[model samples]
Target chain A: MSSIAKKKGFGASLWDYLTTVDHKKIAILYLAAGGLFFVIGGIEAMLIRIQLAKPDNDFVSAGLFNEIITMHGTTMIFLAAMPLLFAFMNAVMPLQIGARDVAFPFLNALGFWLFLFGGLFLNLSWFMGGAPDAGWTSYASLSLASEGHGVDFYALGLQVSGAGTYIAGINFLVTIINMRAPGMTYMRMPLFTWTTFVASALILFAFPPLTVGLFFLIFDRMFGGNFFDHTMGGNTIIWEHLFWIFGHPEVYILILPAFGIFSEIFSLFSRKRLFGYSSMVFATVLIGFLGFMVWAHHMFTVGLGPTANAIFSVATMAIAVPTGMKIFNWLLTIWGGSIKVTVPMLYALGFIPSFVAGGVTGIMQAAAPLDYQLHDSYFIVAHFHYVIVGGVVLAILAAVHLYWPLMFNQMLSEKLGKWTFWFFFIGFHCTFFIQHFLGLMGMPRRVFTFGADQGWDTFNLISSLGAILMAIGVIILVVNVIITIVKNEKVGNDPWGDGRTLEWAIPQPIPFYNFKQTPLVRGLDTFWIEKQEGNKEGMTYAEPLSDIHMPNGSIIPLVMSFGLFVASFGALYNGEKDWAIPVLVLGLAITFASMAIRSIKDDHGFHVHKEDILKNEGGNK
Target chain B: MSHDAHVYSKSQTEYEYTRRVRREAMRGQVTTFAIMIFLTLIAFSAVAAGFSEYFIVPILLLLAAIQVVLQLYYFMHMSEKNHGMAAFFLYSGAILGFTLFLTFLTIVWWN
Candidate 1:
């Protein structure tokens, strides 16, 4: 067994990834799958823009256009953005806290598989019959009215994926709370880890509502349930309340980590400590708390009356103050320091102005009366794209550039990166900024097509042009990635030259098992402090050398998730087929059987001898 | 070694730690089960007592809220360390859930 562990070939490596429970390798899996989904979603976005390039254009049929828009929104949010963030969190958080792995590595792998299968099932609807034609929200009335298996795929797939998300959330919570290295106090933790902690907490509370909502949807469609049947004393609006209650926080869950990423980048590139660090932490917590309060703001035009609207409007506006505080803190951190305008720094700079524009418009919409005019319009679409694309997507791109060396031990070309950045930045604004006017000019959103002479022709054409530019920008990014991988140029630890966090202190191609000795965190920005004092070791040991206990990777998590994936199909086909019940029971029995084995089997982990550590200096030294 | 002595006595058994956690889990399960039963009884009684449907609905809602609290604290372990932060998150969700409910009722049911 030990001999086999020392080396393997391509087939063995592929099998290892399929079944392994290592958080770092699972992160790579997430990146590959999530990147694939991102491109698919991007192609869908281009199609929507093309169809809208001219009024009443038949670039796609009306039904097909709805499906494209729906898939675009759903894919971008659930499959692409969230998993990419999870990739970074999985890859970086344990290393930051000096832990060898997350608290439950098996569950981590299970989460990835569940998400991957769920996404695949949803996309398969395109080939089987049709895709979900309702909007991304899949509001109750529209979804119920839609025919075929589109909405069913939407409900079932989200149910499976949402469960995966819940498991991942719980795992992060336990890992952060229980696994901090000695001397790594809560207050001394990096901003990125703290945000991950808070975001996981949000996921814990938020996803259950979505689970409940999707369950109601599945029951309504497949079974004989009447939870959302308006004629049976059931209220369809309840679904809206449930969806947005989960949905609004889902927005913050994506953006807050993006904010955390930029916070780390700004401090590193500027060669200065974060200004007002404590206040920044306070504002982060405050934003998470207030994030739950503003879901009703999304419901303003649904007729909640004056007082309810007024109260929610005020509550929604309060979120802006803390957000404003964060913006100022980032600028102040770079105000009097040696700021290097690298590709990442350029994106961070771009984010400030772009996100601010999105923020102010959000404040404008917080006025209940003003929202009545903008609801279900292109203006709302523009607003979110600005916040999400302008803010979160930019941060993801910046992190790709910044953390490339940390994750892969290679640096992307700076020249190609900057070109990608400008094209994307300019094209993004060109696409979305004008949509606000189209909405005010009386164009409704989510309509598959519109007639000519609505005053939206030129703006829609311009938006389509911008979408092409954005695609070009994305292509350049792909080129940059391919070139870098081909060159495989190795970089040293602290490749950016001004690293401040614990993650940067670790050696490149970070060992599969991250830290040999737990690091003693002296203060905030521990690495920077040690650098100033001329400590070459880059860290003080928090503990002496000892045998490190490590869990063995297994294939059970994959099988368990796959069992549930198979059962979903059985449940969907229940009434039409004779084998449905048996198939469902058989699938569940497989899952439970694996779980029983897991509980009964006593598999204490193996240990790495101290000598093995000495021999492996080349790995992560 | 001295620090270890202060945190854990040499005579203490691993069994003691395991026993304590087991007791906590057991107590939590019992409390959560009791609350669920009590809430269900209240909901049923409200319907049987011929109360106005409006009154019955509100009473049922209140009982459901109590059950939610029990589940969160006992089953979800929200009452563990960092209780203040945990409570803050729960209360935040409750407040938003209430606002959404009220807004929907007002808009669709009222004028």
Candidate 2:
């Protein structure tokens, strides 16, 4: 176990990663997996764009187009964006808060495995029969009416991963609440930690409704349940209600971390204390609270009554106040400071206008009547891509560059990073900006192709061209990553030299147990404060050197998730396969047995002795 | 350390304060327990006595709600110091849940 840090063979490293519970290792695992999925989703995006490149194009069958778009949306949101954000959160949040690891390292592993297995199960649809084609939302009536097991895959796959998300969310909430280092008050916590806290709370409250909704969906399709079978006294609209309830908060959950990342970038590059810090925190919490109240805004076009629509419309618009406050705060943070236009700062600067554009459209949609015009149009598509791609995706890319040095102790090519940013940022606007006019010009969303006579040919082609540019940008990024990893130049700690938060205080090749002794956080941006006060070792130790207890890695999380994975197969094949019942039983038994073993086994974890700690020279400069 | 100090020579006043606090906690728990039992009986009797359906149903629900609060505050020690975060989260969750529940009752159940 002590030899875990030494460079080893691929097999050994693989085995270590498979069983390890260390947050740092788990973070790498998340990055690798999430990066793979992100590329896959990117490929799907390219395919969708190619199909829509020209009017009357026969690039893909209509049915296959449906599948492609669905997979693209589902994969990007559930698999790519969320996990990429999780990668950052897992990597940085604990470090930011001056904690060794998250509260439940084992559950952290479980969450990752569950997400992976569920994603695998979802993608397996491509090989099996078909992929879910009822849009990402999978609105009940359309989904139920659609033939085959596509919808089933959607329901069960999301169900599995949703559980993982829920677990991870709860873990973050507990970790943030309970695991802060001495003198690290809630008020003193970094904006990243605060965002993580609020997002986790959103995840906690939001994912349950998704779970229940998914179960209702699963039962409806698979087990002959009538939850959404309107013929049997079931209401399809209930699914809409349930889905949006989770769906709306899900947006905030994605964006808040993004907001956090950009906040860090803005402050770091600006080399200033965040402007309106408390108000930013207040806005985040207020946004989260308001997130729940306005789920009905999604259903406004569903005729949820004029009164309901009017109320929700007003409530939805109110969110803009806090969001607007955030935008201004970021702008003010950048005002008159020692600003460095690094690649990350470039994206952060680009993000303000992009996200603001997205926000204005959102408020427009909130008007309910305007939504009637925009619903199901490319405008909504443009709007969301503006938000998700503009905000979250940009943040992910920025964080990738911003924290690349922090994560790997190596610097990415600044030149290539800038290229990726310009190409992507410009390409993003080119792709979606015209789509707004296309929608206003009356082109609908999720339609694979339009006729040549529809007068949408040139614009569609432009959008596709923009997508191609974005793809080139992504390719450049991939190339950049390869070059960086291959070069592997060690740039020690605080490569940016303006790192404000606790994470940058830790020296390069951060040890498994992040901090040797949990550092005393004197104030916000604790590391910056210490740096200012001329603390050479980069921090003040809260406690003296002592034996640190660390959890041993176990394969139980993998086995438990595999149990669910296997059970999903059984559930999918329930009526058709002769062996489905036995398989289901076996899977459930495996899960229960694993859980029992976990509970019964007296694994108190191992301790890193004080002598060993002294021998390992870590962050101490 | 506190246990060792108690085992050694605790001041009379300190011991008395500790005992008094425990006694009060015990009394609160017992009182809440009795109230819960009485509420349960009332719920049962109201159903058993065949009152109006609406009356019995609402009454039972109200009693159940009260009992839950009693359980959380008394038996679960949520009223104690340092439980503010717990209380905040629990109530937040409850409020969110109730909002969803009300939405279902009003809109989805009919539609």
Lowest summed lDDT over 10 consecutive residues: which window, candidate 1 chain A? A1-10
lDDT of each: 0.86, 0.91
Tens digit per residue, CA lDDT, model 2, A215-333 = 99889888889998879988899889889999999999999999999999999999999999999999999999999999999888887788889989999999999999999999999
With a 3 Å backbone cut-off (N, CA, C), the pairs that clash in candidate 2 are none
In model 1, which residue pairs have backbone atoms overlapping below 3 Å? A303-B107
Best lDDT among the predictions, by candidate number: 2
Runs in model 1 deviating more than 4 A are: A1-7, B1-111
Candidate 1, A1-621: lDDT as tens digits:
121136688898888898888888888888889889999999999999999999889889989999999999999999999998898898888878878889999899989988988898889889978999888899998998899888888888888888888888889888988888787888888888988988998898889889999999888887878888879977888888889889989998998999899899889889999888888889888888888877878988777678878988998999999999999999999999898999999999999999999999899899999999998899999999999999889988998899788888888899999999999999999999999899888789988888896778999999989998889988999999999999988786888989898888886667666776778889999889889999887888887766677778878887887777777777767777888778878878878887888888887877776678666645433
Docking class of 2: acceptable
Across all models, the iRMS values in order are: 5.4, 6.1
Candidate 1 is scored at a TM of 0.89
Angstrom error of the Cα, residue A272, model 2: value is: 0.4
Which candidate's DockQ is highest?
2
Give lDDT for model 2.
0.91
Model 2 ranges with Cα > 4 A deviation: A1-5, A619-621, B1-16
What DockQ do you compute for every candidate structure?
Answer: 0.19, 0.33
